[model samples]
Target chain A: MIFDTTAIAAMDKLQRVQFATTLPGPKPLCLVGTRSLAGRSNLAPFSSVTHLGSNPILIGMVTRPDTVERHTLRNILETQSWTLNHVTEEFVAQAHQCSARYPEETSEFEATGLTEHHHPSITAPFVLESPIRFALKLEEIIDITSNNTKLVVGRVCFVEIPDESYSPDGTVDISRSLASTALDTYFSIQEVSRLPYAKPAPPTP
Target chain B: MIFDTTAIAAMDKLQRVQFATTLPGPKPLCLVGTRSLAGRSNLAPFSSVTHLGSNPILIGMVTRPDTVERHTLRNILETQSWTLNHVTEEFVAQAHQCSARYPEETSEFEATGLTEHHHPSITAPFVLESPIRFALKLEEIIDITSNNTKLVVGRVCFVEIPDESYSPDGTVDISRSLASTALDTYFSIQEVSRLPYAKPAPPTP
Candidate 1:
């Protein structure tokens, strides 16, 4: 059933959301992440993080569009960098608490109980608590027009995952970490199906 | 945790990829939508379609760069109009199949056996199969990067949803539609948790 952009458009206000709100969702365990400016540590949970591309490795987040000058957007703009850590169900609660919207001047690292680590290649800090994390360079801050939303795109520069998560061929098994999702009125993840890669075209003949 | 630009910038790619790949497995659903071009029908699937804003109502999609000149992108560019339709779990199979790369001259409506409709407000065709859809006008297109991705942003000119999908408080209950996430290699969506709109602050009786 093909839907047109208009009919698709008519589907209610599902998109233009600020900081995509989720419920008691499935959070990664040990939501270990860090935040900072210049070179300080500010550990935090980034539940709003999302993926935008795979080729060059891009990630995104809908930030609090600042009519004012100070915020995550400003920090990204000023520093031109950021990082995301994958927390397993082991620490999602801690990750949620990371949503503490700390004052701009404070560091989440000192604020949250999570530990911090430094990336070897990039200057960013990462959540030592998180088994996995990645550094990213701010690519753009799209001034989204809907309600007051800003789409922030980042280029993933580095990544860190526990050795067990991905197989040699890049097959990731998230069963180890408690992951999550965003629904209209809730945040949950219920298994629907398991589809393998379209069976490799049945041996091509 | 407040992760900083420098701190966030140093994490690794594998770590970052796992964090950004939100849904663990197969959410075999695509909102089938249509658009009419020069009185013809066009059908396409966009897992990348996520609302970027909501005030004036903006919709955006992170399209796969383009092979042979981006059909939907070109259509929207030419007509300055397009639509979005909600695809349910029922039609996800057909929706995923529509993503087959057809040449610029090919119409997906024919390849995937979809119906098409046109709106009076915009010249682009839309999917008649969709129970709900919306027409839109292009607002902006930002190049997220040089690799192979483009964010197509548009203004919601019109919208349509089933009566059941909407809540009383001006929100769209879009959970009924299927979702897809890039796992190590598959796509899946689960019913994670209910959305939790924050309740009012407690009164200081």
Candidate 2:
């Protein structure tokens, strides 16, 4: 099917969001953990998290406009730190529930029964059940002026993962980490093959 | 295993790039197509493309500093439009080869044997073999001052996809489209299940 912007714009808000989110294909789902100034914890599921660069080791995620209070964004701004826990099949239901609009005082970890693990160096808590997690310090917040959305960039301060999941060459075998994707739906990823770097084909005779 | 930013920084450039790219999990790989003012076509595989918002239908992709000529970025800037064609298992080899540093004068479509399909309204050409494709017009370019990387945001102007791949409620069944992931490797995705929207659990009676 062919769709122009006019046709796409005709879609209702929910439909437009659903379509746009899935268009980018399976996204890596993560539960962002943050803590408020008063020491309250928050957890929220985000599929928008993306790698921005490597040298500074920056990662970014988008948050909708602050029409309503955003607990996760509030906590991040208060603490200047956050944790990202990769969502897996085993606890996806719990992770998804984090999206529920819980009261600011309520902790998703406690409400959903997911264990909160804290690192001494960072104020935010990590999901104890998560196989792979990152402790990140706030780097920069970019305001995407076109839309009211905000892009939060964080620098990796520390990372924790099972030794087996770490490939010898520095890449993490995420399939072993059991990372999943999110849209309006959830999907389990299967690693097909790890091909060598792409190089120009040998000169043809 | 545990890694801190200090440890991550100690790794050489190639190792850091490889590690950082894969840390975000299997990324939605695409062959970005663009055209220069002279009508020259270019295709390059990018894993950095990400959905930025839905209201305005925005998408963003990161481009490394133009220390060296970046053909894809150059073409998009010249023409103000580009196409993102999802890479699939069948043509991954050809898609990967697009990453080769071909000269500015070279056409990756011809070099890699991928066919270019043009829509009536968009000047940039899409890959004919790609089951899912998007035509986007440049919206904004934001510079990440810290690293000098460019984050190019584009608004969706047109989209073409196999009719069967689109679901009734605006979601695309990418498994049917054969979209693959990239990070020094290609992976075939398996759709596990699509769960309903998460709502707060009912309280005890």
Candidate 3:
């Protein structure tokens, strides 16, 4: 079926959400770790993470205006420090539990029983169960005026990956990474093939 | 292994690209279609598409400073309209071929042999081979000053999905949708399980 703007607006609230969120297809699932000024740590699952650049190693993620995820946005804006831990099948359930609307005083690390680890100087926590992770410092927050959502941009200050996953060419083989299609549906990725960089073929007749 | 910012900066250029791009994990794959005001059409593969909101149905994508993708950015800027077509395993080879630096006058549709279909009143072309697609209108472009990239945001004006893949709850079971890690690696997703809406458990005693 096809849905135009008017038809989409007429969709049931929850239905529109499921449809719109998954329309972009599977997203990169990561557990964002942040710390409040009071020293309380926060962990939230986000699938909006996108690679913004490589030279400065920038990443961007979106946060809804009216969700507990705002806590993460607020913490990042205030502390300017956070961590992105890639969720794998082994701990996806625990990572998904971090989405629960726990009170501000609650640390998802404790609430969800996931071990929180810390790098040398960064204050934000990292998931011990996550095989690939990054320590990041906030750079900018772009507001999506149409919807009150914000795109949080960060510069990678530190990086971590398992030796096995890290390749000599610098590609991290995260085939074991778990992905989400919608809010509730989860999937595991299997690398089918890796193609060479494309070079345009001679003009077709 | 771990690398600090300084260490990351010292790495080889191509290695850095692979490392930083895949740092966020697998990304949603889509063929972004746009039409220049001059009447030339363009198609390019993008892995940056991310859901920014649902109510107004916003999606965000990132574009590098120097690449053929700039054609996509320029067309959207000039025409204010575009289409995002999800890539599936069947046509991934053709979709990946879109990344080839075809001349602005060449439509990837013809070069790659993928059929392009248009919706009435919308000039942007949609991939007829794609199972899920969206007609989008340019909303805003936020410049990533840190690295000179731009975050292109668009509002969904229309949506089309396969009847069999779309569920009653509005979820699109794009388990067949292809995902990419780094630059060349592609993966297929398998829906493992769908969890219920998470709610915070009663405060532990």
Best by TM-score: 3
Per-residue alpha-carbon lDDT of candidate 2 for residues A104-179, written as tens digits (9 for 90 to 100): 7788988999999988888999999988899888888887777777778888889898998876667776773333
Predicted candidate 1 versus true structure: per-residue lDDT over B1-205, tens digit per residue = 2233343344466554444454222222334344436544566665455544445566566665544226677777776777777665565555555666565555776666666666666666666666556666888877655455677777766655667754444445455554455632223334343335322224359
| Comparing 2 and 3 on DockQ, the stronger one | 3
Better of 1 and 3 by TM-score: 3
lDDT of the candidates, in the order given: 0.52, 0.79, 0.89
For lDDT, candidate 1 versus 2, the one ahead is: 2
After superposition, candidate 3 runs with Cα above 4 Å error: A203-205
Error of 3 at A113 (Å): 0.8
Better of 2 and 3 by lDDT: 3
Please give the distance, in angstroms, between residue B30's alpha carbon in candidate 1 and its true position after superposition: 4.5
Candidate with better TM-score, 1 vs 2: 2
How much is the lDDT of residue A110 in candidate 2?
A: 86
Candidate 1 falls in which docking quality class? incorrect
Clashing pairs in model 2?
A: none
Colliding pairs, model 3: none
Which tens-of-lDDT digit does each residue in B17-128 have in candidate 3?
Answer: 9999889888899999999999888999999999888888888899986998989998998999999998988998899899999988889999999998998978799999
Give the lDDT of residue A200 in candidate 3.
88
- What is candidate 2's lDDT per residue for B11-98, written digit by digit as tens? 8887777777777665677788999999999998777677888877899888875522288788888889999888777888888778
Which candidate ranks first by DockQ, i.e. highest? 3
lDDT-sorted candidate list, best first: 3, 2, 1
